[model samples]
Target: MSTENTGSLDTSLVAAAAGALAVMCASASFAGVLADAGWLIPALITVLAVVGVGVLGRRLGWPTVGVVAAQLAGLLVILTVLFASSSAILGVLPGPAAIAELARLLGGTGELIRTGVPPVPADPPLQALVCLGLGVVALLVDLIAVGIGTPAVTGLVLLCVFAIPASLADRMLPWWSFALGGAGYALLLAAAGHHRRWRRYEEPDRVAYALFGRTTAVVAGTAGVIAVLAGSVFTGVGTEGRLPGSVPEEFGGTDGIGLQPFTSLRGQLNRDRVVELFRVRGLQQDSYLRAMTLRKFDPRTGWQLDGLTQGVDANAPLPLPEGTTIGRGRPERIEVQPIGYRDPWLPVFGTPVSVSGMGRNWRYDPAAGIVFTQTNQETRPYTQQVIVPDPSPEELRAARGPMPIDPAYVDASGISPQVAELAQRLTADAPTEFDKAVAVNRFFTDPANGFRYDLTTAPSTGQDALSDFLFRGKRGFCEQYASSMAVLLRSLGIPSRVAIGFTAGYQDGTEQVITTEDAHAWVEAYFPGWGWQTFDPTPLSDGRTALPQFLDTALHPPQTPAPQPGQPRPGPVPGAPAPPVAGAQPDSRDVPQQRREPADRGWSITVLALIVLLACAGAATPLAIREIRRGQRLQAITEGREGAASTAWREVLDEVRDRGHQPRDTDTARQLADRLVTDHDLDATGADALKHLVTAVEREWYAPTAPSDGTLTDTLEAITRSLHHNAPLDLRSRLFPRSALPPWRTTP
Candidate 1:
């Protein structure tokens, strides 16, 4: 290829390599932030590969070869990183032993969400490697089709498409994710090549390039800033269901029922149910179910519960119960597992004493045992710690007293008479109001004799749901049981309302994590002497009791031994050392000693000295070589009889000057040549020969090229003699008299 074409190709290759580097950097940075896995090594390798490809293009003068090499290298690096980081990134390592466990977990929740169920005891490493291999194949195919194109833009698009899916798949078919990434890389290379080809025929305008570069930088920077700000806001609100910077107002005036988390469809449904069921009671307090409190709301999503505002005071006290003494025991941790439906209202036992590990906006309801926060409706597991007052069985039994009828309960003007008649019939047999309340509770709780628990579907409306549950469909979920019990108690003039909370949760020794499937609603009846007490009208299953199986496991995970009274407890995990030991004294042996040394004699100083020495040595190497060559050239010039020796010398010096150097205005060609030889340590013969060549150049410029054959031959021989001997004049020195000279020169 012509020199011009060769240069163009090299430039294109450099551009392509730079584009690849940018893609690799973006991917690496993103992975670092999201994956938290060991992805650095692969990212570094990919970067190095891009650099290598760039260097190879420059050295070999071939863009195509460089592009191909880089694509292959990038593919390898991506695969390696995916495989190595799969375990940490996917949260599931491949192995036969883990496949069954993974399958169970995935099947339980993953299936409901449209994700593929993973096999039991999977082979994480192999899965990852296979996925990576496939990704490479896909990438190759894409590159072959698209050709080399704009690497950065293409890579970014690919990243957006792959991020979520890859993350999810990495837990199962990890190898598939790798394959997908490979495909992305290949597509980027192809796109970059295509862009280059198009640009060749239609040259890009300089203004456009500048505009695009600036625009990309500005937009990306702006987006990054916004993401950071929004993330910060989400972290602030805590769990009180309150938005940051917003003051809490009681819901619907004085009756104290707080606002519930109501962002998602499910949450909205729950809220509507609560409002409909309790609005007419007048005695119902403004109650809010606290899930996650948001002190920050995104301008985009508005104020929703997913955003968590951190740093709020989580320990603030709520309105207390009359004559209730607060206890200082360890808090009971509750975990709620998500079974697919998204709702902000988390159910818990009635009358929570205190709550811990929740957002700041969350307030406790001493009357109802519910915690609520304004949170996003996305399905995910949530946890919190609550203090439940320890009421002895005797206290609970003896605490029952006459029910005080709220004067507000006397009227039901707007309500249908049928509803009132049904309520009275349900509570009719009992004499005391308390007895009537128990009768209503027993009617729904008797599953074998009356009610049944079924989650197959929701109840249809039009006909009264209570009558249907009583006459038609004997089986029902918590909503039916709780709804029926509430209506029945209302019939007898005893104040009663529905309560929603998780029935049970998975146990981890002493802690319970409630899953979303455990969503339940029951009833609470007020007793004049004691207060409102929880009543689950839902019957227990044959294999289960009131408590859930998961709750039992969670509340009490396996435990390790406790340390002495003065010693600190072990870490959260079993058999782990305590983070801080009680009464353990600090030792002086662990202290580090400081050392003082002379700064002037440090390694940096030594390095500087060595560099100076090497530079001096470099300056001498060319001089010695020139001297040896000049001796040989001089002998040839002297022996030739065709031309004068002086003429030969002049011709040689002129040739040296022609390459790239010209003397200062004040100096003649010979003078300049002589000065260069001396400064650069050229030998006597080399210096003299250079001086002679300068004279020939001057002579030729003035006298022309009419020398005799003998003269020409002699001149030619002289010029050829030491053309490669003495170092040429420094280009910088010749061009700018005041500038420092280059270290060494090579004769052409």
Candidate 2:
């Protein structure tokens, strides 16, 4: 290629690099201001990496696709390597582990987005996603603006990125988000365009330079004007149920109620201390005591229980949701008594068929199974009659509802992009609503797919909690998992809501004394015939499947009838079946309690065993290390080399020692050689090698003017080969050479 062509290519790559940096800055600004700075670091890294690779590829005379591919492939590798530990284990560069790590990170990023709000400290997964996204943006900028010479097309991407943060609030960000991005994009386009024209002419012209400068100024000025206009128009333009900078007080925007409800929600949810709030009695089996239902979900804020409330009581038969099936469940009774906090919402085991002993101020919502008081209800005992649904997963999916009953009942348009996609992908294979619910429940509850039951892992407040839990977090207690499933179900056009309260607690014989630790949340899918069916996707510590609904079926493999015309009916299991009913609520019948988990045996013993092994290994490691250090110290003293030469000698000796040829404190040069010859079954050549190494080392250490010939190193190399062949069974030793480290460092 001619010098002119080479210069043009260089100019194009340089322009592309500039465009990438601009786009990276534009996109990363959102993460930086909304989230912690950790997210931006990877984006910066991506820009640098893209620039490096693009330049390299161009210089190497690669095609456009090759250059872009090289940039993407190389940067992806770098990102995977740099952050492998965050998402992967058994790190050996790229492998199954690396891919798993990448998937894990992406999944975690999704979780953070769903479960956490903006302004939280950026985690590894979030950072990785930002970097990966920036890499793609950079590649596109390179391809469109630089490679294709349509530099203006790249501005569209940068502008869209700039719009995100700008739209968050009235205006929290400075003008630079727009200015920096727009200026960089314009400069890139102008430069690339001008250089291409100049290259076509094969020479520089003053008039051409003047014309280019004029054009560049116009584009840059236009970009600046547009950015300013965009900021002015879109900034602080958020409406309710949208992604905004702030939400109303009712939406828990100020205190982060939607995602972080433990503040006033449950006294036990505190990090420092857990306070018992309530206790339950008169139940054959254990069940959760619900505080509230987040039926109204908004992406701008999150699922809110702050929606409109309706008043109902004894005189009013506690209005049931439309199309609710009656006799599908057996009647169960639970008595609740508040202790630490005077929580207004009533907690029930299942769908409240009837509520007795509550004051007149209490209002009921059939959609959420919520009973709230207009004023604070005193801490008093109340008994609730619940209908525990025994509908099969098939029945729930086949549920039919009154068309357009209430928009509030099936309202779910606010599901975030990440969460919607995940929910869609997860339930795509399943054709029915119950199948989707079951699929989602299985996915969320399974440990292998990156979900865990951890109360300590708080859902990040302010952002979409479901996305965060599913992708980035993977470890949250009931609230996150339940909300995630509920939102997914809603997105799939299935009515689902999260029930927050206490799970089954320590049974003090007849009375189950519920505690703060029992505080939990789970999804309840709205079924037409069975009403709201329970689906707890939070994996419990016990061996029992978290999906109690599916556990029995899985164990006994239920037989099913042929599919019906509309949708198949997954009726109640034969032995535990309840008659289909015609009442507004479930028809009362004989109820048998399900078995509960043993209080003390829920924690995993396998994890405990691993912990014990690790602790024991840690304690014993120092002592074992001390002995190794003593041997290495003695060996080093016997060798007695110093300075840089010592490093090389030590390296060679460590290799020899690692191959099962242990160094001895007493062995001299002659003794060690003899031992080596005997151990290796060395013929004349191997023996000669040992002899040569001894002579060379002796000369180097003891003689003032040792020979500078490379023979010394050569002999040591031969000895290394001999040791490898002689002790082929100790490959672990070669990988982890104990003697390579210094004495004090190794000696505990």
Candidate 3:
């Protein structure tokens, strides 16, 4: 086989590989943000496939545009195979069904990106989304560095990738990720520089070339360090503050607030010190401390803090839930002192009748069944007179109908088919709605099902995630159990919502001290005769959970009417299932959770805007840099600096190169100027300017004692203006100047 100039194609693949390495390093920032690293596999495959397509197309003698098109098509096919093969034609090509499936997956990904806290589950949808983004990045790197031939600009694209995790991560990104990103960028620069050396210096001096190579490495390393430090400082990774702004509590008048109960609950529980959030006094019986109620269940997202309760005076008597009799509820007074917690929502026990000793900023929303404040949730002591409903087993058993006040309470639109079928199967023999609810709870807590409370399980809520939890990996924390049970109830045509708060904490003297470890979630099913009834499904081996009176009565009835003390708390109907745990604790390492403090909505939007701006800026960076360098060279000529004649000549050649003309290495200054005049069909002004520049350049090279030319800068500017006026395609040249890249050789 005859030798072919395949150097350009080889260099392109090298640069593409550097981009892949950089992206993988940046992906490490998501280690704790996502449940696992499974996304990396598909993303790696996507980048590799894109590079492979470019190499194949170039080897076949295709033009740059055709090569790029092939690369994009290859990306689509790879993604279809990985994520949407079921809907694809021949399980390879993307058809209409495949496109629709990809769109649906992206839609869910958008919702997750918009509302999710860090450490969201690494499900198939999320992996697909990640692969798509990184694939696009790879294509851009190939086109810009190899096709467009400006490898230096690829650094800006890499920065965009690194910024994502830096902005969203709950903790500081690992140090190795930053180091790898720097090394990858340096490798890319070194590769590009090496290619340029081979082309520019035919008989290169070893000492000079080595010095130039060292300078390039130093510059690349310095740029990388500066970028990482700037991003860290600007994103405020280790600080509790946002980017110098306050977000609206209502989040642009959106219906629901962002609540990451699973993330935050796990974080608190895993903390080294058990933080006391609230102290409950005057509690004659155990009850779950109500923090907030999430009434909306999105199949894409588990639970949402939907809609605001109508604001009423803090001291006013809150309206009772619908279907609740006013006098049937037994009244109880409880005093609560918030200690270390600061949130928009306040915690209260049972249904609030009235609240005392709180500021006017606090308001009760009876419909939503929680107390909230728009101003602040500063630590304060308050007293509440609330009613705890005591519905007997007979009343709950007779309860009929779904009884949905709002359709959201019973909306099961996006449930997985397998999950819906499983719900039907589990409750098939149950005679009543109450029995169906009990059966679902029992299925989870029953040891025969092999479900275990493990904090390390991925807390994903997608269809695939739900199937994995119920059918395969039956392990998770309170958030999983509560959300799963609530979705199951809705699938059975029952009204249900997930409640988040602290369980009745360990009793300490006269007060029940609720700690961070006590953060809990449970299902509340609305019965027709009664209101929302508590059902705990998480099986905690710990003794922190309290059995609700109604569930206890329904499961195991007393033999006599009179109450008996120390009855072993009705040991869960003799092997039916145990009462759920109070909350979750740490596994091996602490799972860093989304901060429970006020969400920095404005900060999030600002960071996203900055990332978009960086991408836009990256595209135009070469043009901007070329313009700046042009100005500096012209300024040096005007000041009569050394080498003014050579500077003027080189500037003219670069302008010629940008306008689609390449001056050969053997061409003299006079010969190049003549070609530019003839090719561009220059007018008298342009021809005269080129003649003046050519004379100065020849004198500078041949005559050592020649004086500096006074009119060199003016002549260069005149030629540039003439060139702009003559060439119709000068605008394209200005934006993507060909002179920014080194000349490359290719053979068909």
The global C-alpha lDDT for each of the candidates, from Candidate 1 onward, is 0.39, 0.57, 0.69
Q: Give Cα distance to truth, residue 726, candidate 3, Å.
A: 52
Candidate 3 lDDT, 333-399, residue by residue in tens? 9998876554556688787788888666777776567777654223368898988878776678787
Model 2, residue 167: what's the lDDT? 46
lDDT top scorer: 3
TM-score of 3: 0.44
Candidate 1 TM-score, true structure as reference: 0.43
Off by over 4 Å in 3: 1-270, 400-404, 458-463, 557-748
Give residue 49's error in model 2 in angstroms. Answer: 79
Could you estimate the TM-score for every candidate? 0.43, 0.39, 0.44
| Model 1 C-alpha lDDT per residue in residues 257-375, reported as the tens digit of each score | 11122222222232211211111111111122233222121211212223222322324544433223434223554444443333334443334444444344443433333344444
Compute the lDDT of residue 64 as modeled in candidate 2: 86
lDDT, candidate 2, 663-742, per-residue tens: 67677877877876777676676578778766666766778485443444345445554654555434234223445434
Candidate 3 or 1, higher lDDT: 3
